[model samples]
Target: MTTPLPEQAKSIIKCCRNGQLAQLKELLSEGIDFQLFDSPLFAPLNTALKHGRWQIVRYLFKENNLPLNKKTPPIIAAAQYSKDNTTGLEIVFAHTGNTEAVDTQDRTALMTAALLGHEKKLTYLIKNATNVNATDHSGMSAFLDAVVNQSLKNCDTLLKNGADPHQITAQGDNAMTLLLQNSTPNPRLIKKLLQQQLDLNHKNNHGHTSLSISQSKHPKIYKVLQAHIEAEKQMELPIFAPSNPIEVAIQPEKNTIKQRPLNEEKTPTKSYSETADDRSSNQLQDTQSKQLSVELSSWFQAATSGNLGLLNKLKIQGLTVDEVDSKGCTALIHAAGSGNRAVASFLIQNQADIEHRSHNGSTALSSAIISNSKSVVDLLIKKQANPAAIGPGKYPYITLAAAQWNAGIVSILADAGAPVNTLDPSQLNLYHNVMLAAEYYSNIIKAKDTVRVIHHLGLDINQTDKEGNTPLHILCGAHKEKAYNADDSQIANLTHELLKLGALSNLTNKKGFTALQYAKKHHLLNTKGVIYSFMS
Candidate 1:
């Protein structure tokens, strides 16, 4: 049994936690034995770490060099904090060489990173975290948590790092079925996972295979699975389905130079990359797009400004209230986002679609909760909006509500029959929708970034696609694993192979940029080096 820490020890820890580095240093200079804590958490190092005092933590590690206790490993503590930076975590790796340290829950830092969708951190940790299949007390691995939370990049990282997605869930579900049970089925991610050779024939404990799970709920993913099965008989990897209104599909032919399991000398494991356009024509299109956005954005201006008279005028002018912008943003969505309760209520009263989804898959309710529009949220729920609707990052409406820190909204959603795991915050583990949605907005921010990947396999490195982008340009701005981009022989061998494939560094795309030029424009400096090294 642990004893209470002495007053002096507690004060030292307090200084560490509160970032009182000056006081901590003074106390340290006075020769205080900092290891007087009765518990691991009370230690100055962990206290500094838990509170994100990276400098103090670094100071202790560098000066005193205290042996780390497993009660809260540096990586695990870093993973726990949503805002922890790479430099803070680097302090740990610089001093110590182990990331496999486990917390009380048997959860490794990688699992916490994956559970929270810390893609960049997870990539760095993957090097030392060889136990990609490590599980928590609840038998949840990083792969399982990634799929359940719809952490696309984390899933890709775990898969690449040798996480066994085939590992059964506590509910006895395979990777495919488990993924279907949670997410809306990202057909792009689905095709990639299936291509990893997951079994479609494998059944869950409920006697349902991936085919059954996807066939009923996700017809697109079902088709993808069917296509894969067919392709298997012909022994070729299946290409993505055509673009649709619902699910975005993958096109593998975009960048397939050739497959060699080689990586760069640096091998920054966190692989994620470049874009170009006709200089004048592209500027003209961007201006037009902005003009069109302004025109469409005015659909909700009347509502947001609380000018019901203007709204009525727009209605009289044949502007349907439900009319959406190019991104499917409706007036109601706009009202909800702006927290204009009056307009939101008015729109709802006049037959606004409560559940209409924007191009990004967010609804009016999602916008409302994110904006802390408690009144609008209550109104939507009372009007019978689907409380269980999955929003951005594939999180539940209640889960998204929880992220806003609105107790009232969370309570309302819970009472509205939200399909959530728990209402009590204490019971909310990594798998809970509440925790899953914690990183929802962060994931969405990364969603817009084209995380380029240097493909291990390719058709012709010099081959030009319809966009006038050669394999090199696609290498500059391609999606690798999730929204994070990977690029040029950050896997060094792929770069050498790219050169052998006759990819001309000087060959320009429609944007009139060569491979090196494209990489420069896209800020793919690593790729620039790779292309430059192989240039004639």
Candidate 2:
């Protein structure tokens, strides 16, 4: 607002702000400089773009070769706000070299597109941007921004394109903690961090432990951490016990041995006192336990590898399909996790437990999501996979998928009548799918484009959460979140879309502030402008 506009640029700004297409055309005909770079906030070209005078934007682009500005780069602005104007953005991109221009928040154009779930711009920027790992003021890279935005594919793209997964935030949040904080800490995502050997032990300011930060909600992830701990524990003992307590190997009575003291002399020996018979018996028991472990372990291997022949042979040999491995993964769970639909179907036909939880509290349904196999997921949901049911049910998996705003699996679950109106552990209802995504959209998003694939329970566009936040209030940052506020630029664009969807602007939230009032209180000029335009 402090940026000054030239007298001629003022007339151009007025024409654009008022949507005066004819006047804007006349002004353009006079060969007046459209390169108003001095005051980016009040630049006539940017003003027209901001007000969404697309007819004027398109006309100007077609008729003139406008010079780019470092402060108010056309490509940056178009990528941030004008999502629908793809053609205009392409034209601007061709003329702009300022892809790395950071906003006041220190987020580059790439970061903004990544955070907004702007698929096209994100893809383009990932390939063209000089530094995908560039951090903002908060030490959050574009890859981190993409994770906060919750686009699994985009996160994958960034990671593959050399984005640093090891980067930590100002609050000491690493990749693992950020994913956990977003409430979508699925094992598949956590696996990537583990594979990179990223830190899971560092505590943020929240006073939570390595796994506690993740809410330790993901049982499979505990195994990732626990597996290492268990390995270290083995080094401390002669032979460590295996994890699966389900199959206890019965052993003959044997003499208990005690550690013997070793002399300090050069010829000292360390030994445990036990009868020869006892040692022999212990060896036999060890052999039996290893055999049992191997037999059970093969079941998981077979399930994961789609070895139908081995599975059928085991079934004929009287091994139950419900037999579990050390990790508590039944054959069905292994099959589902690996997306072996044929094997999953075979196990299910053989009466495999549909909701059987592994030792880590994971299930076939969650495993399917980890595989990203929509077909497997759809098949389980059709067989009555309860998403809200806890006690090792689907709640963890549901929370794992909480931030997947536009995932097709979400729609599949919704279509199958997943109990979305019910609250999850976070006290969020179905729309957390959208709300979680919006949480990272700091000054970004193409409202309808982002929310179009989302399914609302009973089509209640104005339904309130436990916090009494209607979608409008939440979209306008009327919720109780303290870490980040909704971006004013995003709120404006999203406000217009929500209004189109019949969001009630007059409705007050738990704190008694309507979306517009909340915007005004927060000094969200763009949000106010959009609401005012809608009202008018």
Top TM-score prediction, candidate number: 2
* C-alpha lDDT of residue 519 in model 2: 76
RMSD of each: 27.4, 27.0
For candidate 2, lDDT tens digit of each residue in 320-397?
Answer: 878765455677876886678889889888888998876556678766754456788888887788755442322444
lDDT of 1 by residue, 233-351 (tens): 32221111112112211111111111222222543334222123345546776565543433343444455546677677667766676877556677788777667888888888888
**Model 2: ten consecutive residues of lowest lDDT:** 247-256
Reference-based TM-score of each model: 0.39, 0.43
* lDDT at 372, model 2: 56
Stretches > 4 Å off in candidate 2: 1-277, 294-319, 325-327, 358-362, 369-372, 384-403, 425-427, 440-457, 485-495, 517-529
lDDT assessment of candidate 1: 0.60
lDDT of 2 at 219: 62
Per-candidate local distance difference test: 0.60, 0.62
Task: Work out how many backbone clashes candidate 1 has.
Answer: 23
